[model samples]
Target chain A: MDTAAQPDTAPAENLSAKVYADLKMKLIVGQLRPAETLSIRTLAEEYGVSAMPVREALRQLASEDSLIGAAKKAYRVPDLTPSEAANLFFIRAILEGAAAEIAAENVRAKDIKFLEKLVQDMDTAWQNQDAVQFLLVNFKFHSRIYSLTGNSALQSMIESLYARTGPWLAHGITELVTIDSWMGDHPAIIGALRNRDAALARKLVEEDARWGVDLYRARS
Target chain B: MDTAAQPDTAPAENLSAKVYADLKMKLIVGQLRPAETLSIRTLAEEYGVSAMPVREALRQLASEDSLIGAAKKAYRVPDLTPSEAANLFFIRAILEGAAAEIAAENVRAKDIKFLEKLVQDMDTAWQNQDAVQFLLVNFKFHSRIYSLTGNSALQSMIESLYARTGPWLAHGITELVTIDSWMGDHPAIIGALRNRDAALARKLVEEDARWGVDLYRARS
Candidate 1:
């Protein structure tokens, strides 16, 4: 809530762009709560800019469905509904599964190493009880695989889905932390990628997404 | 290009909503050309509204990726690119296939009949060389199946993808008309739904999406 902007070093014209990017990141990282009402004046004051940029940023986010437009010049993060979460899980399964399948065929040894290192980082975060770091690293892990498809459009679509789900995931990080066997299939997924078993990789990725949904449901 | 608004019969506050919905429909039906520039002032003048609503509509469309943001207040439909189109096709195949698979399990007898009637209508359009009607019917046919899944989120996501690809599909309708077998797998898809064969339905839907991509590539 105290996400005050540091001094605005960005150019005048890019002020709105900077505000948009910052707010988008906040939504994606789950720093903002669901159903949280956001006032342009408040965000503008917090971000050390005038209300104009904040207004534009809110409009953009509302357009993306990351934020819901309320009354005039007011916006709120969409409240998470169980059905909406389930639908997003179904979609993530399809998209991430497709990405994993394509990446399996195209994955390089270096990519494997990169993902392995991320898993290691996530493990460390888990052990240290750093849910935030764990969540961030977990995102990077999947994003890397999706990026291997060499399709920016696909990556963007997948990322947008993540943005929609991230707030919920963040809210449920406590439950995620309690699950001892979190990311259970990640190693197998990596194995499939290493072996170039596209089908197995896809299946594992889909299952992994479904498992997240299960976790969310249980916690909710 | 002369998509002027008839009159503002809708309530005053809902003018922006109306503009957004109208522009969205135009995008989905492929009435707008890819890469065509859209000016807020011109649109406002045409729609018989202030520039505010038109600007908002453009922002919403750009957020959905159906249109590309150019300058501060300018927008354009995203130009068709082979790779972007191919990526969309792959994603659509995965999504539509999943929708079909789920719908196969949940589809009612009435849903099957509805789809059958649509296919018959499309056949007539095809026979009459009414490319526009054929394209519209083709969309409704697939949309009907996706709706049977009973997942509004999935339907919305699928619809957004259609919005992105619709202009390209519209541009390629002539070539689609020339093709002897435009919807080769639709009957099989309907048959799978009738029989509740989820796997076959999924496969057919995916193949149908891929075929559309092939047609687009050929035509473009």
Candidate 2:
């Protein structure tokens, strides 16, 4: 989903999307917290744009559940508990699974090679204890597969899920275990894609979601 | 999805959700076409409200893909072709299937009894050649199952899909065949949920999506 906030023909849209992407990355990187409010005035001044586009970006983020919008109040980041994150991840898994099923049906050798490179990079990032690098690469891996589906609505839904649950995904991921345990499904996904095993690909994508649930349960 | 726009604690939120729901029904019933632009001013005037809530409603619709937003232009109903609708339906089927799987695990006797009554009503609607009645009941039947999932994110995702493809669902539905042919899966779904067969429920839900694809392919 990191297509670099490609601009639409409209300048307003470009600005809105730019603001949305900036806010999204901040959410993903744990720069924003649920307690803080995102003021249209502040964001407008910061982006050096009118309040209109900033307002639009806030509305879009609120729609995505990335930001909580209260009546007559500024939007804020949504504070998601682990269980809540698990529930969100449940939808994400089903969607990513469906996306993988589509990808498996249409994947090419180059796609497989690209995915393999990501898996390697992700493993390297994990080994280096770089959660940020690992997650960035991890998102790219999933994003590539989602892109292969060519469903913008579905893609946006997954991206929203990613953005909405960004902090949850970033939180304590490295605490769970080494890269082998967390990144275990990447190899299987590659194998399933290579074999064009839609069901296997789907199952594997879904299977990967269990870690978050188990992580929550294990602590409980 | 058609549960009368539930009012929130915030008056502004209630008004926005109200406007969103009204516009959603219009989209579902095909009162609005893709050619007509949805101006915030016109909608605000129609609803006798200020421009802010109307603007929020339009942006929400645009986010759900029920409306198309171009840069510096009013939002318009997205013109979806059968093929495009089919693609969207593919994702819908997957998410709905996941929802059904959850429902199968939690569905109760009373829920089954209620669904049975709806099925009977749906059959009667089909027998009377009432597309509107049939669709309303059909949506209710699915909504009940989705509600049992207790997953609002999943519920909203499915709702967005339904809204986004409302026109497609309304187009040429009865043209395909008799009620028995189209509504054949309702009984099987009931059985699967009653038996708590999560896998069967999921499969049946997914299978139901094939009809739309088949109908489109047959027409092509």
Candidate 3:
């Protein structure tokens, strides 16, 4: 399990928000392992907070399906069956594809340049064998494109879908290094975005999402 | 604003779950109004529970985007702007369309019969001018089709999307009576499902979801 860093003291009312954000970030970064039991006391002790905030945070994550409430006072990160993982990836494909098509209609030169930089950064992360940086850049890359559509609801839904798959991706970061073909598709997606080709961009984005499923299946 | 019915006494350990479930149902049934402020103390009193469970339940709903936290210790049902609601509906079209496509592949004869019965019930509700029953059957009809896909994650995602629109639907029930064109699309969806045509099912489901947006737009 990846340990959480202690956060600075926040005002009393904001403690739960602070804890929830920190815990969600940890889950997104793959710092937490799936099926790992999360004890309120343990999390509180680690974060130097009291149990109340931790309890609230756990409930919030549980609502998002980021954590499963196994029993009274027991919460654990959910372990995705291969099929669940595939289903999520399929949904992401549909959503991200739609997002890309919308974004293409709105993409400006600056947006294309920003995406180009992200793809460049991802290549650098890949060359350095920095899985964490690669994952962060990769997430931002897609997120940036999704944001171009200016649809908060769609973007948030996509983020939530990413959160569902984040732990599994974190657990299998090493597998990403070996899956050279997986990252190979991003350049074409970038090209489609650069060319403002809505159809091609949508198709490539969907293909990229499927590649993510392929990576997960290979690792599992 | 629609007032919530008082819940029966729940064990201390399950109070939060009970409150969450009750609140969600109210939203689903349109008992809660959009942009209605939710006070913890008031809800605690109404449910005959403590502030703790109410607080937790509100946080859970906030995470689901069912309620928006506006300030410290204050939450409200989100009032969708026209575009925001349109975006959600578009995403629903994509998601429910994919669900229908998958369901078409896995649908059994009995599932077809069950869906046909739901369509029949919806017609009866419409004829009786019972908007509440129409809404309930409408929800169940789509829900039943989505479930045939046997994808829990997809089903849950679809349900959450429904939650986002439920309060608005509830608030606009009377408007449904004025919109005869809205329910006219269901029979075609049922026909596509009966034929077990994945592509047609997907297209009709997407069109059906758009009809929901049309209804909302008309009411707004």
Candidate 2 overall Cα lDDT vs. reference?
Answer: 0.77
Candidate 1, true inter-chain contacts retained: 0.64
Clashes by residue pair, model 3: none
Sorting all predicted structures by DockQ, with the top scorer first, yields: 3, 2, 1
Clashing pairs in 2: none
- List, residue by residue over B1-220, the lDDT tens digit for candidate 1: 3542222123325566678767766676677788888999989999898988787777767756889875575688888787788888888898899999999999998988898898898899888876556666787888899988887667767777877888887777754546766566788888999899999999989988897678876665
| lDDT score for candidate 1 against the true structure | 0.78
lDDT-best of 1 and 2: 1
Order the candidates by lDDT, highest first: 3, 1, 2
Q: Highest DockQ: which candidate?
A: 3
Error of 2 at A6 (Å): 12
Model 2, range A60-172, lDDT digits (tens) per residue?
Answer: 77876788888788778787776678888889888998899999999999999999999999888878877667666777788899889988888888877877766665665
TM-scores for all predictions: 0.87, 0.86, 0.90
DockQ of each: 0.52, 0.60, 0.63
Interface RMSD of each: 2.6, 1.9, 2.4
Better of 1 and 2 by TM-score: 1
Better of 1 and 3 by TM-score: 3
For residues A1-220, write the lDDT of model 1, one tens digit per residue. 3541222223334666677766766666676778788999988888788987787778767756778885574688887787788888888888899899899999999999999998898899888876657766777889899999987767767776766777777777765546766667888899999999999999999998887678876765
For each candidate in the order shown, give its overall lDDT on alpha carbons. 0.78, 0.77, 0.78
Model 3: per-residue Cα lDDT over B1-220, one tens digit each: 2333323223325888888877876676566788999999999998787899999998888877889975575799988776777777888899899999988888888877888888888888878876656666787888888998887777777777777887777666665557667666777887787788999999989998887677777765
